[model samples]
Target: MTVSNNSLDVAVLEWCKLMADRNDKHHWSHVVTDAAAFEGSLLTAIGMTKDEFAGYETAMRRYRDKFIAHLDSDAEMDIPQLEQAERAVAFYHSHVVEQEAEGIDLHGLPATGAQMATYYHAEERSAAIRYDAAMQPVAG
Candidate 1:
């Protein structure tokens, strides 16, 4: 892997290299457990199953390969679902990073970023309703 003089080439090549599945020890499988990707283990963490993950990965690959990396004949392309990716990352963080790597405390964060997002969204809706009820017009 020789270093390229062009900045853009460096960035693109780095991504391509990372995405390639040489299946060596550096591969993601070395860290991500089947149970973490599929089901609950002793950690009791939950995430997308292998099939579900594959679907998301396929969508992303199409987007990356056809949409971003290069242009194809297709006028439209399927987008990767970010929420799905987020859950997978969250699972990986808890399953591998926190468990395997030492001294990384994520104590303040929610189990999933989605949980915090949904919680705040719901809170906004609830607050609006409460405010509306309190500010209701009184008829004498």
Candidate 2:
């Protein structure tokens, strides 16, 4: 059955939100990961058969491309923001935790990292949960 692109888009965004919620408050990776999964689920909900979808080699590649494209396509950020983000992972050498920890009071640092990590990790987990719910045998 063909699905409405608008409806699918809404579903995709909703799943992305769910993913964001799952990821630790600070962990952004999970959001990306879940958004990918959300994309995959949208594909399936419209009926990509197990055999057809299974051919994708664990479905990891499917959403990964979309996620990267999404990052590349963000219109709000200018070169500077991209540069800062690049610096974050590259120059600043900030893992999600370190980025969140920078300049925070010591007492709050540990708690904040813990919270963010939990949030980000949760996003990944939520994806897995939904994947399982989708009844697709996950290869990895």
Candidate 3:
């Protein structure tokens, strides 16, 4: 196989989109705060306070804005911890999706965004390996 690496990775951008703060971000907002729901935030279920998790959310937003959303070189910063981001996503699935997503039929699907990305990476890797093998020259 000639090609050393081949993979599509847009996880950070997608994760940032989910964690972003916007009026249209209904599900995320509902999980993060009680602004839209009469019940309190689901963040507590994950053993995190709004203030505690806000930093992670903010980091994702900044990463999205400065890097993925734009080429703002001056504002670019380090990505947030993957474990923190994945935890937030998992919490959303359990607290909101399992509780409120009636008739949505989320069964057989990965529970978190990180798990979904794993499938994408695996598929891309398989395709790349196949392509590399196919392109190998026949022995003279």
Candidate 4:
């Protein structure tokens, strides 16, 4: 079975939400805590058991580290902080795109007022991009 990038991203977002649950505190506690919960769920989501999922976690950790390094090299901010910020941005963008594209209205979505506001902001910006692109002159 083929898993799309969107699915992976959605899974990551869900995992992040799980980590950020009121009882979990994975965000303020540590990255490993989030990763551990994410790894297990993601592996199972893609079809794998705990033992078989360990390799996937290792690979994901390596990829995340590389991404952090690249972001650090490109920006002045701390790598870990940048990575976390970027992940949140990416997750928010993905959810907004998914919901809007599916003709789903997100007004007053439950459990996340700030997040929904951010989604609306992103959707407005994205809509402007689409309008601008449509208005642009095309070369023959």
Candidate 5:
């Protein structure tokens, strides 16, 4: 249970980072030709329309900025309990996981929490590298 809870915390934080990064104009400007088009592609790939993605991103960013990113004195962030975290994971598995999977059998075998944590860490590291590469000034 502890492992699962820790895994959930890591997953949530990873997702928060993804949301925050995607919404950042600086990050988007570094990689894509048209930000809106790139965002639309991302939203479609994630099984959400532009408006839906906007609402979800807005909420996630609010929580991320208030709680995870800074220790804002006046920010009121509602941290989810373990039960809520479990429910969120279950919900994602049921609804969102399939959409994200591309030819991979996500439901075939469940990975342990430790495995997931490692995977998430690797993914974050790779994403950071990609972001840095995109931001580098191109030689003429």
Candidate 6:
């Protein structure tokens, strides 16, 4: 796949994982839903205004609900989702930097969505390779 294709696949896969985890019986959805509920606080924490944060959230939600989860027939995948994902990833990175600056340790935090996506894509590629190898004719 081309670089763009690989990046898009990673974004779509990451979005799918987010949706699944968020909707599962476990309290994962709390991460996103709860954060959204405290939009004011989170915005302040992230150094973003409500409008800027809303733009990011809207991009992600539209991509998730319309393209990833529901697959709305009228909705077409767009660059906004990719842009928003990159922005969100950067937001998280800033938090990490801030924590480090404050002398706080982050040994147990979960990997960022972008990191998870890379790991998932690697696993997928490995599985495909194994499957293809298994399907090869035996050289008796």
Cα lDDT for residue 33, candidate 6: 38
Evaluate model 5: give its TM-score: 0.38
| lDDT tens readout by residue for model 4, 1-140 | 12233434444444444433324544422333355554454444445566644444444444344443243353333212223333443443443444323334544353253565677679768866876777788989
**lDDT (C-alpha) at residue 45 in model 4:** 49
Clashes (backbone N, CA, C under 3 Å), per candidate, total 0, 10, 0, 0, 0, 0
Assess each prediction's global lDDT (C-alpha) against the native: 0.51, 0.39, 0.59, 0.45, 0.52, 0.54
lDDT of 2 by residue, 8-125 (tens): 4444343333322244453343423344554454344535454553343222222333542255553443211122222222211223344333465345443454565566578758
Return whichever of 3 and 5 wins on lDDT. 3
For 1-140, candidate 1 gives per-residue lDDT tens digits of 12212323433333333323335454455644563433444223435555655565566666667756687889776654455544444555455544554444445654444665576589768866876777788878
Relative to the true structure, candidate 3 reaches a TM of 0.56
lDDT of 5 by residue, 1-140 (tens): 44444554575566554344655543433434555655555655566666865666566566556655676886466654333333334433333343434446554543444555567579768876876777789999
What lDDT does model 3 reach? 0.59
Clashing pairs in 4: none
Write the residue-wise lDDT of candidate 3 on 1-140 in tens digits. 22421111155566655665555454365444354441244465556677776776787677667765786867436755666666656666555444555555667776555676686579868977888778889999
* Better structure of 1 and 3 per TM-score: 3
The number of clashing residue pairs in model 5 is: 0
Better model by lDDT, 4 or 5?
A: 5
Model 1 stretches with alpha carbons more than 4 Å out: 1-26, 32-47, 104-140
Runs in model 5 with CA error above 4 Å? 1-26, 72-140
Q: Stretches of candidate 2 above 4 Å error?
A: 1-111, 137-140
lDDT of 6 by residue, 1-140 (tens): 35445556567556545433346443224443345544454455556686875666566666667765676887457645454444445454444444322333445443455665576579769867876777789999
Where's the lowest-lDDT run of ten residues in candidate 3?
1-10
Q: Evaluate model 5: give its lDDT.
A: 0.52
Residue 101 in candidate 4 has what lDDT?
30
TM-score-wise, the better of 4 and 6 is 6
